[model samples]
Target: MSNHARELAGIIMNRFDAFYRRFLDITLGAKVRFESKDWLGVQLAGRQRIRLYDHHVNETLQAVRDHMGGAPLGQEGLKALKQAFNDRLTEHANPEIAESFYNSVYRRSLRHHNIRAENLYVHGFIRRATDPDLTPYCWQYRTNTGALGDCLRQVLERLQLAVPFSDLTRDLGYVDRYLQDHGPAELRGGEIGLTFVNTLFYRNKGAYLIGRLEQGGLQWPFILPILHDDQGGLNLDTLILSKDDASILFGFARAYFMVWCPVPALLVHFLRSLLPNKADYELYTAIGCQKHGKTEFHRDFLNHLHQSRDQFELAPGIKGMVMSVFTLPSFDVVFKVIKDRFTPPKEVNHETVKAKYRLVKQHDRVGRMADTLEFTNFELPLHRISPMLLAELQQVAPSLLSIKGDTLVIRHLYSERRMTPLNIYLEHATDEAVQDAIDEYANAIKQLAAANIFPGDMLFKNFGVTRHGRVIFYDYDEIAYMTECHFRDIPKARYPEDELSAEPWYSVGPSDIFPEEFATFLLSSPRIREAFKQQHNDLFTAGYWRQLQQNIEAGCFVDVFPYRRRQRFRFLYQQGNDKPGDGASPP
Candidate 1:
């Protein structure tokens, strides 16, 4: 039995190495894809990368089952297997991730009751070692000896990009001026240093150079979004300074960045230093290791449960017809389970709902959709669950839950970052805040549409407000691709009775959507209606949606800046180019 366990551990490690190599191979193509401006290729690569983990896990699960002769490993066998796995991980570059892969294999190969430290890596056992001889993942630069502009030039030159900058001198001038005006006061005459990640982070149509600026004892995280201009030249689109804005750039709403790192653990460590508020799991997920992130989250959550006494209760918001959500008050994540039966008007089955969440996982979120971590055979202690919440779950999603002893096993569920539901947010918001949320709500719709996604149900309850005040869509039960939908304008009323009828007189197909009726359901408040009309009146017309569909069909990639427009140095430079007091600067 011990020999077989050792052999199984070796096989799993071999499988992990293969997966890691393939992951890096796919990640390496991101740089070439960005240089060639292959936006479609970027999307394809993203979907493929996201699918890799599960593909390998399923394959390894089959291998493990075959090796074990399709029988469960008893406690002694499981203990021996875990020990062998840990023994093989001593010098591993990413032992935490490898342990996670083992956990996935164990979880899928056995029943839920088999979950234990003896069989799975419930918590990380391998401590990361800092090798003195290992190469650093960041390039360090000192601004103390040279002009800031000179140091910036060296940083750009070090990238050794496949394409040349559009106008390095001009961009440097803009950076200099912007820093002189908006940068920290201490940066002007104080000693400063910059540390940038060695590899560029690629996602969608943009590449970002992530770094930190240090002066005195303070550190400010910064990001430079590099873009390919219309003239086929590379240009730095904007400079993002401050931790708040940097965190937004890495917000849970955005798609993962494709970053190739030889030493992923070291890279995550470096990123943590720059974004201290971000968790290790978030940093790993942002860099495209979502499976590992899920593992880290599970470990952290269990640890929190052990430390805290908070009970799991129903998440505060309008009840979801398709998903039953609950959370621990002290935690920032919500666990969502698909109900056995959805409420009327939902019209979706369990498999379909899972498919929609899968779609969200594989699609480009464009910073307007939340990312979810899917899990199966998850368990929780029944005692920690509030009685009210337990009764609610048993009522709606009983099919997904089973009470075995003191443990409640969830067959499957998704975990997502918690945010204030948009409807709940608007209830207490001041007039000004309501107006801002309304505008942001409209902008979220436009951005999702631009990315070729249509929120099938655009009610306020379907969206959420992030900590940064950005609105994002969270409901996946009623989402569809823009190209998959048929946008249509309502015909003029043929009779007085037709005008007053609650139901439309015209025939409607499954894929057909009437944009004209959107305002009726979306804008109930007069203030919200007027504010939405001021900025997004065109959203109510079918023409706007049709144009977006056409653009998507033509393979046009829309520019969606993660940062605000005013934060862009190019716009500021354009403002300066215009004559003073002329008011000719672009919005």
Candidate 2:
């Protein structure tokens, strides 16, 4: 390799290492933020950390340009550069991440339009699953060697949290009861041992201690949510023993976690072991590597095309006026393109739609809004798209799509995890299921509100139900911040003529919102109306929204537990104080 290529590689690696250290520095503050109750600082740190990748990428690109003395790299030069880069990764801890960083620099600096294997790392060099040197980043505990409670105690102590556990013995009893009641036979028989990731994951008010219990063939994942009490002590909020619960905690709807990961690839690998069904992109994004997650997702998508025969069709839901959505039957994601013109009653423009999505990306999702991956000039095979879907896209968003021989190119679009539209799910669901979904839908609205988001369109069609039966809002074209909205009540008509008018008698501002009118459209079905009113009648009142806005404006951070309230340890064992040895038995 030429000295320029090797020197460029060295400079890139140095920049990446600096970026990684800064990332870790921000993550390291999570514990101190939690200890000192700096909720606002935590939120700011999350937003700032998200922008670091792009900042470092731009910096690295400049450094590479200066090193090349403004000379463009030809095909041979690019190959030499790539090879030199690969050689530098022989025994590196985060080879895949560094490759992703290099790809960003190559693409942005070179103004690269096409994805070429020679110039960029379209496919990762590291085979993570089979890599022998992927060091173990977790602590192992053999339960059969000692009592389970003792092992749990040791695991808690390993975290070395700034605040002490308020009642370790009581929390242990709670964990024991959960294991006895919910665990598989292996857990009760002392056959399963625990393997905890060495780092604690911090998000919002919670610091999660995540691990998996396995004994030969049987494996069960768990997450222990550690929360700080108002006092200078910590408490075990809950014991999450189910894979479903663990997945929810790491769901796409939630904000990214801040965890110390020396080798992010190793951490992602460890998480994938616990969550075999979770995609590599999701695992990376969960651990705060969203830029790399985008790279992984592109690779996964390309691989899926080779492995499946399914064609892309219109996503199964009511058509979105501002966006056209399509999905491949065999794939778990949907691609959305902004329409050339929105339909009536949808007043948002293209830029407005993009701004709303960006707001969702920057704001705390609060586990109620699905995250989207934005892409530019994305391509798909024309033959793979169904005729109807293609026609629909042409009619709705022709300006966004173009054809180059067999390929259909989208100038800009977003890809998101597909879920069953809540309206569609409710239509086919049983009575009991409908009731459960209604409750969940209401909770989703409340949670989004508490996070300062107002889903401007609260219809069932705007929301989707994940496979885990959780309701998450996906349509972002009409979303607004709760603080920006003016919650209002419908005023009484001043005259009989006013009551008969087609439009509202009261003058409304652009930001004015009548909460009472939400029910007129959302609760049209009698069963849904009854069920929604049973648990969330307050949601229909202006006061409910106004109070939330007030709290948000006052800088109050609401606690929205990922798990069910019934699963909370404090709720489960309410009889005793945090003082241990209070003679409290498991309820």
Native-vs-model 2 lDDT?
Answer: 0.85
lDDT of 2 by residue, 1-587 (tens): 79988988899999999999999999999989988889999999999898899899999988888887888778888889889999988778789889889988888876646556668888888776554443367888776623778888888887787789778888888887777776665554645678888778999888999988887777888778988775578888888878788889999999999998878887876787677889999999988999899999999999999999989999998988888888998999989999998899888888899989988887889899999999877889999999999999888888888898999989899999999999999999988999889988988898888888889888899899999999999999888888899999999999999989999899999999998888889889988988886768888899988988888888988888888777787766676644321110121
Clashes of 1: 0
Q: List runs of model 2 lying over 4 Å from the truth.
A: 112-115, 128-136, 575-587
Q: In order, what lDDT does every prediction score?
A: 0.84, 0.85
Alpha-carbon RMSD, each predicted model:
2.9, 3.9
For candidate 1, write residues 1-587 as lDDT tens digits: 37998998998999998888999999999999999988899999999999999899889888888887888777888888888998899878778789888887887777444577656777778776554332467788777623767887888888889999888888877777777778765565657888888789999888999988887788777678898876679888777777778888887888999998866778887777677888888988998888888988988888888999989999998898999999999999999999998899889888898899999999999889999999887889999999999999999988888888998989898999999999999989998999889888988898899898999989999899998899999999989999999999998888999989988888899999989889898788887887877658888999989998998898888877787776776667765543221111122
Error of 1 at 569 (Å): 1.3
TM-score of each: 0.95, 0.94
Model number with the top TM-score: 1
Q: Which residue pairs collide, candidate 2?
A: none
